[model samples]
Target chain A: MADTNETVLDMEVIGALRALEADGAPGLFAEIVELFLTDTPPRMKGLEAASDAGDMPGVEAAAHSLKSSCGNLGATVLVDLFKQIEMLGREHAPEEIPSLVSKSNEEFVRVQSALLNTK
Target chain B: MRIQDGNDPNSVGEGMDRHLARYHELKDSGEMPGLSLPEPGNRVPASSAADGKLRDEIIVQLCEGVADERRVQRFREAWTKTVEIVSANRSGICERFPYDEFWSHSLACGLAAHALSKQLGRGNAEEAFLCGFFYRVGALALSCAFPFEYAELMELRSLSELDELKSVERDLFGMDHVETSHAILVDLRMPDLLCATIGELAGQADGGRSELAYLVLNAEKIAGVCLLDESRGDEEWSAIMEMRRELGLERAEFAELGDAVVRKWWEYGDILKIHTRAVTTFLELDDTGITERSLLGLSKINAMSEYGSPLTVLIVDDDPTARVILKQQLVKVGYRVLTANDGADALSCALQHSPDVVIADWMMPEMDGLDLCRALRRYEAGRLLFFVLLTGRGEDEGIIEAFEAGVDDFFVKPTHQDVLIARMTAAKRVLNLRRQIEEDHRQLKQQLCRMAELAREAKDAAVTDSLTLLPNRRYATRRLSEEWSYSERTGLPVSIVMIDVDRFKMVNDTHGHDVGDVVLQRVAEVLREATRSGEVVCRFGGEEFIVICRATTREDVLLCAERLRSAVERFVTEGLAVSEKITVSAGVATRDETTGNVDALVRAADQAVYKAKELGRNQVCA
Candidate 1:
């Protein structure tokens, strides 16, 4: 199902991109987006599997890494969502993980589209 | 050019231009040393007192073959004595003034002048030394003539604004310090070379004041450098950088020389008990800096400690957050950490930085981790780069692909910092072990080189005194016997001058063996320097030397011995460990019709030396 409420590209990322360029690391945002696209899917898959298996540590670790990837790419909302999932996993409470993870996957899809278009 | 490389991370390109612009702005704004550069000519480059002895050593190195060591020593003594006389005379009138401080500054300038001249190969060390020390005569005269007034003036304005002070002095009393000093030195009948040295300080570049003159000016600057606060070291460094370039000095060489100068300055203040303003502590030689850099700077630590240094880890991930987490984890364990974004940057950074371990994300754009590994393998197998590829996909095919692409380890999507560090720690230990082995291999290579050097030296050194570096007794005997046979065949006379240091045992007893060793060495140098072309000088035994003067009779032999005696008498012990003068006595014997063999000739010389010793030491006897 298409999420109508989603904004593809986050405007906040433009500031981060400009800051990176000013730091003499121009063209870094594209590489960061590519890494986010490449790594998030597997990490998201790990969180889903670990949550289903009730492997709390596995879910926590996967969510944490995924959070890092999103944060770096300036996906602030996604990062916040992943942070909640990671905290829940760390507490061994997988009950709310299903809803959060589903939203995460949807957000990932939007992020992917936004990143490819930005590229 | 040597000071900063183009590719160096700490390049002074843009930053230096900014600093230069700021300096010019300050100049234009009349902040400091503006376009109103005081009067006409600049102070000649001269070394100051703190490292004057070290500068003299450098001068001696330059004068290796061109100037006689004895003559150089004499010149240095003359300079020292003249300065002592001038200052000693000033002590009567300027009793309350800080003469030690003033004298220390003069000494530093002289040494700096000497070192600069010797380094550039442009001017004479002697003239530079004389010019440097005596140039302060004007200030000394002012102090001596008008003690209270000079003291107030000096206290009001330190030497940093020496030119300003001079200008002020002229306003107060029709003559500046330099002018007064010049007049005083002229009245003292200072040599023309010394006078010309001071004159050149006022003279401009018609070929740049003989390079030595520039050194006199540089010495003044260097003395100022030693007086600057550590926080303001950049001023001194900027001046040194300019000097190094002008003198065509290599960066390392200049750094080494500067270190010597600073250390020598510190020592001078320590020895003289002069209450100098604290000098800048060079960062490279700082104890705490060394410890800190050893922890962080792997490459430098590798050079410093030949055994082992920390292994460098390069974390290559396009995700900046991932890279940061990984780098922080690695660095926490004391590994040197570097980071790169994506595969291309990783590749370039890896090649440039030469990290020991490289961890890369598998699916980066342009050059993915797998492709990066393969390219690295192809580019150089010697990388020992210990490639660890991070893949989100744990499928067998992807794993197989990673191996095919030459990855050494596989790390899954989420790397637990603890587990990663544990594995990397193991990797680091192995790398350190490898480095140790490499160090041992290098040391072994150096040992082989050293053995070769020792072998070469042994060939010559076996017959040479290790202390005085003169021909030993065995060589002397052999040389004399050979000369004797030649003399017998040619019917030409062969004479020997047997010289011994006067009361050498007392010298050893008074100054300890170290000073005794130096005295013996000095005496050898004097004898060697005094000998004629055909004379073969040798350290026959303890405090005794034999010179084989070929084609010479007793008269010629006595003359040679007398010259050597006079030279030894003139040698000063000011800079040496022992502060007492040393003398030598000699005896001459020639092979005439009555002489039996080389042994008899040696015996006769020995007997004559004893007679000379009995006839009051420091005389040549035949």
Candidate 2:
């Protein structure tokens, strides 16, 4: 469980985010964490729907959006899974995108708890 | 400083000649570093036979970079040759010409004119550039023509007005720089419009000046501010502010133009191989108290947001978090921020606020960023809006497509605060320049329309009677000539019905000129209303009128004259107690073979009027 947690979340990226706090007001990081928690679910759902319908462009766009949101909060493992899904969609490999999309959802669950703890 | 002769080293003192000779000896022996060129007296002709084309090409390149092609071509040949002539005799010209100050000022002036012309969108950028460069050529020509006298005259420039300086120049050198510049331009066969515009700068007041002339004037003032000493009288900071207000620029934007002028001046100096001194920027001198504000979070925002009406930015994203974060960043940097959930929402928000900039995410549900950009561009106000697209993909093909849809800039998300702030600053600058230009264009168009209306009024006043509101004698004569020529061409006899108010002298003596004027006005109205469209009735002079009848014979004119006489008799003059009834004596004359010309016909009518007066008052005669 500790090894999986180490791979899933990047503490150094969270420290950099903390440095962006204006005179230690404690709003930017919480705001970004809240945004990531709200923004990723709908995008992950759209990525699954696009994979089911074989909509390559839609899958690419949704995965790309999710990847950017996750990367902002230092969800590196989930970001990597979504990046692979985005590439599969871009390259028209619909067969491989669904597996990666499911794996991304599992990793996103862990990133959400880690972000909630950090907040 | 007074002008110096470069060739005469002994002019400075006795020991300088020996040092100069020794320096030249070492220079010729290649022991000392020097430019390898012919001595002052040993140079080629003004044409500079060798490397002339290369020199012209260099000048052409420099000019092309500074001004537009069409305007540059108008004076390109003459301008290049003048530069060559000056360069060939540079030492001699430098002896008389205040080379350093004049060169720097002229270069700055030309650059300012080019930038100003483009900014105003007047389509005369090149003409402005040429005008600015040659504006002070008269001083150079004067110096060359009368070096000693012109040098002494230039000393009075700071102390005297333009007219006073001209008078002094006339006393000393027999002519001033304005006249000399005019003569030089005419000799160069410059465009008549350019010559006339630059020649009219003799008067300093801006009233009754052409737009091109004003452009040159302002360009010179801008150059004065840029290159001259800070304490110079004509180039004071207040003068720049006044011109800025006249140009319809906010304080911040005017400082931007000043910075551009200085930057371009240095670039032009490099191209022309002239030395440029360090310039204190207009922005630096303009301490608007914002710079003095403490560099804290909220205080810095307060100081910056107080500058000249804060610009608004509309942030659009399907994601709520992206929208909120971006809005917060923009608001932190003093931007008035509007938020929207999607592209459709952004369009409505933009319409309500008319935001200066729109930043929207590309991948939206119904109307994406590209579609939103296209939609905004369809509106008249939206066409000027600065649109930035936020995309996750920074693909080249996508950027090209986005640009085709009218996106001004692009930002990738998740956005960095620093990058967003930088983009906002750029947006503010571009928007300010565009708005200033638009205001200037609108004002210039209105001024042109007003000037056209005033000119029409002046023309009408010149040929119209002041009191009677009828055509004056000058218009009558011109109409008579036209009618006479028409009669000769078509074999039609034209008739003239001359009218004179009866007992008009008594009316003036009894009342006053005011009542007499009213009497004449009443009589003019009678003649005007009674005459047909084919006849032209004019107040020939005081209490006298003439009706020109085209295609009318003598018989017809007699009846027309009788009709006018009866109409005047019937007109009861109101508001005049002394002269209640106004009547006129009418005389008719027709063009025939006996009356060979217009003057003879007019004379025949005059005699006929006298005959009517002698026979009986208020009667018609032929």
* Per-residue C-alpha lDDT of model 1 across residues B1-622, encoded as one tens digit per residue: 0111122314324422322332233335443221111122232223456445644554454344455666666565454445345334535354445566666677567656666666677677667766777676566655655556666887777655667786566555445566555554544455667766665553323574656567777777766655554445354566655766677877556544554554444444333333344334232333112211122123222211123334567888766657754554454344557778877677656655567888888756577887778756643322456788875433345787778777778776446645676667566566667677777987998998678669967785457677888989989998999998899999998999999888889877754565577678778887788877999899999999999998998788888899889988986353343445788878899998898888899999999999999999889898
Q: For candidate 2, lDDT tens digit of each residue in B326-401? A: 6656654445567888876776557545788898888788888898898778555577889999876444468888
Segments in model 2 whose C-alpha atoms lie over 4 Å from true places: A1-28, B1-307, B449-622
Question: What are the lDDT figures for the candidates, one per model?
Answer: 0.64, 0.69
For model 2, state the Cα shift of residue B574 in Å. 64
Question: Model 1, chain A: how large is the TM-score?
Answer: 0.80
Query: For model 2, what is the C-alpha lDDT against the true structure?
Result: 0.69
TM-score of each: 0.30, 0.37
Q: What share of the true interface contacts does each candidate keep?
A: 0.17, 0.34
